[model samples]
Target: MANKKRQTEFLLMLDKYQGTIMKLCLVYTDRHPENVKDLYQEIVCNLWESYPRIRRKNNIPTWVYRVALYTAYTHQRSRKRSVPFIDLDDGFFETVASDSGNEMVERLYSLIDRLEPEDRTLLFLYIDNVSQVRIAEILDTTESAINHRIKRLKQKLKKMNENEEEQ
Candidate 1:
């Protein structure tokens, strides 16, 4: 009964954040669909293993993001095939086709694709509009570190945009 209840709770949370989780998988897996799927499963498995340790019900998204990024980092470290994050899924195409924000989103991700893994994770969380404190907790770093890195990232992205405008 306890196991069943836990499974139900897990499923509910997964449903609530499936899109966000999938996006994290894409960003971390370098947009390789196969790798994204693999990372998605790995995250789910990791969440199951760690779920028992969760104390705060309100912090579920933070817990999920932390597990997703950590799994991706470890997975990438274990095997290295420097793949470009350029692959587009059918869903991605559909989104671009239907959304007016396509070009801007694509351009932003293009800049983000150049970031280092940790920075990329930070950018992802930032773009999601996550609070700095929550992001710091998820990344297992200090808020000051998160703040400093975000400031740097903003400058880097701004420079890239400026350079593009000059071209």
Candidate 2:
């Protein structure tokens, strides 16, 4: 009975957060449908393995993000791959750095695909509307550090846009 109850609870959790996990997988895998499937499976297995610890946490969403991001990061590092080339239009960077929040947020994934693993995780959480406090918890960093990094991330994108214009 206890085992069955645990299984049911775990399923409920997975069902609730499946989209979030899948999106992270897609981003980490460069939106390759095949890789996304594999990564999604791997993330689920990791989540299940850590479910008990996860359930004990006050913020399940943060725990889920932490596990999913860490799993993606580890999976990415274990693979042997060359740097991927991402080609975008001239205006891509400009829009990313633009004042239009919805448009920028929608296009954020494109930029995420080209970032380092850590930066990608940060922006993924940011765009998901995760609070700075939650993000700090997820990344195991201070809130001020998350703030500083986000500022740097925006400036970096703006600089990239400026450089592209000069080219």
Candidate 3:
């Protein structure tokens, strides 16, 4: 019965934050559907493993984001050296492109995709309106550091956009 209750609670938590997890996976995986699916499963497994301790925490979102992003980062690093494990069907990129109708949004996403994983993660948290203090907590850094990095990220993105326009 105890195990059943824990399972139910875990399912509810995952359901509640599915969109958040999916968005993180999408961003971290460069919007690759196969990679997104893999990252999502990996994140869920990590979250489940930490569920008990996480549930006791005061801020659930912070905990969830930390777990999801950390898993994505670790997964991304491993994937760099591993052989391409999944051969997604043709037209996958085309299908994804067809789904998004906004040119500016697409451009922005492309710029974001160019960022290093850490910069992308920092930008993701900032864009999602996570407070700098909370972001600091999540990333295990000082709030001042978060502020400095965000400033630099903004400048980097601006430079990236300018370079894109030049090309």
Candidate 4:
């Protein structure tokens, strides 16, 4: 009974944050809907398996985000070779095409897609409104290090955008 209650509570908590998880997956997968769905399932499964061990020692949201990020990164790395450059399904393209946001969101995600896995993780956390302190905790880096990386990423993204504009 106790285990059932705990599990129910955990699922409820996860349900409340599903949108955030989906958004993170969307961002991490470059809006590739199929990969987004895959990553979402992987993240949820990881969180469910890790929930019992999470305990009260860590912030649940922070821990969940960390797990999601790690899972996405690992999945990306493992599939890199087998995955084609443009493997997005029709649904994936539809989601991206339907996005009402200005070109900046698309451009930003394009730049994000170009980053290395770890860099993409950092940028995803930063964009998710996660605090620098929380991001540091998630990435196992100091806040100063997180700040530095964010700065450098911004500069690199700006340069890339400029190059794209000039092209």
Candidate 5:
């Protein structure tokens, strides 16, 4: 029965946050459906491994974010060296097109892909309105450090945008 209860909790958590995981996977995998699906499964497996330790409070997403992002980062690094880029079908683009007003969001994600992985996590949390202090806790850094890094990231993004416009 203990195992059953844990499964129930895990399923509930999965149902609630799978979209976020998918989005994170999309970010890390560059919208490649095959890679995104693989990352999603991997993140779910990692979350299940840690599920018994997870708290169900409002901070559930915080813990999930840490696990998901770390898994994405590790997966990216491991695959970066040898993964061949086969041409993917544009099925994901079809979904994007059906969702109105998401073209800018897609373009923003492209810009974000240029950032360092650590900066990407920070930007993801900040854009989602996670408090700097909470982001510090999630990322195992100081609140002031999070703030400073975010400031630097903003300047970097701004400069990139300026340079792009000049072209």
Candidate 6:
């Protein structure tokens, strides 16, 4: 009975944060719905497994975001070894065309994809309006470190955009 109650409570907590999870998945998957679904399931499974270890309400969002990022990174790494880019259909464009009003989202994701995994996670959280302190907690880094990384990432992304525009 205790286990069931805990499970129910955890599910409720997750339900409250489902939109955040979906958004993170969308960001990581580059708006590919299929990939988003896959990553979402992976994140949920991870969160459920780790639920018992979560002790503070304040930490839940950060914990969930970190798990989602890690899951996406692992999934990408595994897929890279076995699957070639040509084998996978790029469905993100179609999905974005149908659902999004902001055309810049595609361009933004393209730039984000060029970043390293750690930078991508930092930027994604930053874009989602997470604070530097919370991001540091999630990443197990200092706030100054997170700030430094964001600064470097922004400069790199700016250069990439300028290069793209020149082409």
- TM-score winner among the candidates? 3
- Candidate 3 vs candidate 4: the lDDT winner is 3
Clash pairs detected, candidate 1: none
lDDT of each: 0.78, 0.77, 0.81, 0.78, 0.80, 0.78
* Model 1 poorest ten-residue lDDT run: 92-101
Kindly list the per-residue Cα lDDT of model 6 for residues 1-167, writing each as its tens digit: 99999989988998898878877777676455556666777888998898888778777888888787788888787756654332234465345324566668767767777778778888888988999999999899999999899899889888887998899
Clashes of 1: 0
Q: In candidate 6, what residue range of length 10 has the lowest lDDT sum?
A: 84-93
TM-score of 6: 0.83
Error of 3 at 136 (Å): 0.9
* Model 5 lDDT tens row, 74-148: 889877876656555657533632334668987877787888888888888888788888899899989998889
lDDT for model 3, please.
0.81
Q: Which ten residues in a row have the lowest lDDT in candidate 2?
A: 89-98
List residue ranges in candidate 2 displaced over 4 A: 55-57, 81-107
Off by over 4 Å in 1: 79-101, 162-167
Check candidate 4 and list the clashing pairs.
Answer: none
- The parts of candidate 6 lying over 4 Å away from their true place are 82-101
Encode model 1's per-residue lDDT on 23-111: one tens digit a residue: 77666654555566667778889998999899999889889888888898898886486554544465643442333466887766677
Candidate 2 yields a Cα-based lDDT of 0.77
- In candidate 4, what are the lDDT values of residues 58-109, reduced to their tens digit? 4887888878878877877766756645555567435743565878877777
Going through the candidates in the order shown, the clash numbers are 0, 0, 0, 0, 0, 0
- Assess the local accuracy of residue 154 in candidate 2 as a C-alpha lDDT between 0 and 100: 91
Candidate 3 regions off by >4 Å? 85-98
Against the true structure, candidate 3 reaches a TM-score of 0.85
- Compose the digit string of candidate 2's lDDT tens values, residues 3-112: 89988988998899988997787678755444566577789898889887754655888878988888888888865564544454345333423344567644666677
Query: Residue 84 lDDT in model 2?
Result: 47
Between prediction 1 and prediction 6, the one with superior lDDT is: 1
